[model samples]
Target: MSVTAQTGQRDGTDRRAGADDGREAIARRLITGSVKRSYEPIVDLDWDSAPVPGRYFLPPGALSLVGTELWNQMTVEQRIELSRQEMANILSVGIWFENLLNRTLLARLMSADPAAAATHYALTEMGDECRHMVMFGRAIEWSGARPYRMVLADRIVMTLLPHVLRGSLLWVAALIGEEIFDALQREMLEDPELQPLISRLMQVHVAEEARHIGFARDGIMRRKPIRGRWETFVAGHGHALAGVMLRRLFTNPAMYRRAGLDGRATARSARANPHFQDAQVRGFASLAAFLEEAGLMSRVARYGWRRGGFLR
Candidate 1:
């Protein structure tokens, strides 16, 4: 018996050997269509663009300890470099998440019983993620910034981890990451300081991302029963990974260097900075509180919330 048959039979579905169901066929077509629709970014985004309104790009009350200190100390050229680094970091994070999402969707599609409707949904999701990566990558290049070097840990996770592990962890991670990104994008879209180019990009990206968040939540629910212990493990590890990723966002060494601060010192300061504490309180803390209220926090906490360095 084929792998699909082995799995499908247990689930009360008859499977044809080496042939996918009508639903899977439709799913593949939908995914291909969406991918084609999103393939125009290379020509769509103008690479020789000027800075959009400064106000729209910068979050309110968001400050890097090094960035703030460097503003007080750095020359104009230095500040520009720092700004580039910050943009690189943003682009890198976006690209990496997209890559992970695609990989996870592929894994889900491959592992799913051939008769399951979810398989088609997973394929469409994979197409969505692929488009996201291309969009973000083009955005970075258009902004005249180089891609950020993947952090060592991120490199390992992206390159060396097994697909099953990466897929599971990323699903949970997406839940948190997408939520924060949605909040940020919503704020940016409403800001008058945003340029037409960025506003348009965010508008498009946000609409697609909203659907992805729902898919992620549903995917997790569907898999949790069969993969509960595994999901829990990923969730625990996800907390630490989330913290590391968050720390990178708030205090990248390259960003500090560009902004005219001692990179190491700036990283240290940002990690211990009062601004971050406030951000945690108002941003992540609120998020955590909400998860707890929803009864999801205990499972997350069990996985590694305390170790992830966000709650404490």
Candidate 2:
């Protein structure tokens, strides 16, 4: 073989070997954790009891629609109602991303080596996400809140998710979505004033998702050196786009309607609310650090993230 062809073959071998090594190690650990400790949402939660009415479903600061003028004007009951609606909306977003993630992992498995450790872990993750979706759906049903559907743009993007959310960049997208929800749930778990059912649900999710996030981080680190300049540029932009989608996923006008407010005006005010913007920045800070460390943060991506209001 010619020099270039020989080099290509070597690179491919290195990737396959690395896949079975580093990626598989992370996967094995995750699978062991899953097998040792996993809970069924149906049996784990006290579904017999309903959430207390007029109580916050989530803490006030964590609600995406808070920090707006409209929020300031709402009565205590309205605020609590909106909190439930907002938490439901967050769970709906989680379901959306979970669906996309499962698709990405399944597509990955089609080409993955059957004996590779990551393959088993990916299967484990898919099962976990299925349970999570059911749990989140139950939470929304319990709250009597409507599940937020993805906007048209987000739906359009889902068409390409199978292809886009793969390879080295796959874990980048995974971390962004996982970490955002993780931060929210972590806060809810620490606050005693939040509703008990919601707290217990979040507690379960946070426990399971910690393993998933570790797998994503390990995958990203394994693939870091494989990306070249052009690949890096594309990955950066892809991460930026994912960030934008995540921010949009957090707030919806329909949530305003559920809260008994004018949808358009309230959403518009939320868009302009500096407090909400700051929250987004803070929510994404650790994700930004990870991207920076992984060499996925480029100037172009930074611009997109800042312009999308996900980063300062």
Candidate 3:
């Protein structure tokens, strides 16, 4: 090879090495921060204290039927119960996503450099996820709400879209699971009207999720880009559909039945409710913009985002 060609190749290699070193430094920092701030949710949260009466588990505006005529007909007690149920449902989705993330993290470790700080951080993050899942289940128990189950269609779609949690899309899915909910819960955490127990729960989850989001976003920005239009299309659409389904999993049909509402009717109303759609658009706005700017979004992904109420 010509001397100039060799020199250019060497420069490229050095730049890549520098980038990897920077990422390792970030992971090492995260590892240290995690050790300092990680909470043992079982002891950190007061599990034995009963929920306060006349307080909301989540904000009124966060509920699916908040502004609808149907919501207006419900008694204040019913509305509070509905909020509790929805919070439980949110926890259910959180558990599912975090559990999936643990599995994905372990899988990633198989081919990763075992001694790398990034690999060690992935292990540390999995510990955080385990505690989050336990916290979620315990919080649902505290609210006296059963764990929400995903709808059949959402389950089927997840079964079909394996790629959503592989390649660059894995980090995208992680961000989807963590960021939107974290953003929405920030509003919940600040509200004094929130139930005391729930206030603590949100604080713990949100604090840790911030770290997890950083990890995912860093991975996405650094991962190898997908090649070819077909591969990009598959990644975009598959991820888009997966994201839509993830949102759907937040509302369990059984939650409505337990709250004394007709499950099907309420589900339909919630799906069409302008308030719910607006909340989704608002809550997801930042995450969607970030992914799009990262070039992770495609034309089909944009359509899916709109359909999912994640974008205007």
Candidate 4:
């Protein structure tokens, strides 16, 4: 996309200042939505009947290894087992991401005016994330799957990116994490072949994440006016890299090892799988659309997004 096309978004010129009150109204509506729809996983989920046999913990198609040659060789039981471990790892990584999100939000809140409605909504989102972390932890325990930790490189990248790309990329990255998971979970919740426990967990998550994504998208729009050319370049590439990183986090080699596959080889196959890449393209469609509309998808950034498999 050209610079002219980027500036053409929602009427051509920078509109951040005029969008402030509108952003606040959106935030207020999100708070109301959260109050009405927020869920308690412990009280709401059935703890005794988890891991119900003959059902997948995630939809088969959502698995990174699915449709690859290695996955074709797995027995029904092996497939289901891998799904359980993969889902656990995804949830565990979610917990890690949520911790970062909470801290980032609190740090931003410190400078934000306390009386603003956006600050109140940020607090509400922090509370929702706290509940989600506990919910993910319990699900991991009940499903008998172990949590997966970030690799050293992943940890280092995650730690530094927030500081390096504070305004635009930071918010866009958070939005991607929430929306990509929400997109997959929406499908899982409706999949009859999945366990009821997994479906219910997704139900609660998807319900609340709609509001979170809204706030993040709104934030990006508001920040567009202040971001200069260099800042836009940095944010664009950073957002692309962040999307790829989040996708990698979901497909752990440890999951393959636990499921009795050759971890390294299976991970390699998953990375090369055309079906998996297509799933990523589909999963990230909404996010890509948002970036384009928000005037964040510059020509240089589009290169990184294409390299990252988030665009193309």
- What lDDT score belongs to each candidate, Candidate 1 first? 0.59, 0.81, 0.81, 0.80
- Model 2: per-residue Cα lDDT over 194-226, one tens digit each: 888998998899999999998888877776776
Per-prediction TM-score: 0.71, 0.92, 0.91, 0.89
The order of the candidates by lDDT, greatest first, is: 2, 3, 4, 1
Cα displacement (angstroms), candidate 2, residue 98, comes to 0.3
Cα TM-score of candidate 2 = 0.92
Residue 26 Cα positional deviation in candidate 2, in Å, after optimal superposition = 1.8
Segments in model 1 whose C-alpha atoms lie over 4 Å from true places:
1-48, 52-60, 66-69, 73-81, 113-116, 166-170, 222-238, 280-309
Number of colliding residue pairs in each model: 3, 0, 0, 0
lDDT of 3 by residue, 91-206 (tens): 88888788777877777788899999989999999999999999999999888989977667656754544434676677887888789889888877878778988889889988
Error of 1 at 171 (Å): 2.3
Task: List candidate 4 segments past 4 Å from native.
Answer: 1-17
lDDT of 4 at 134: 92
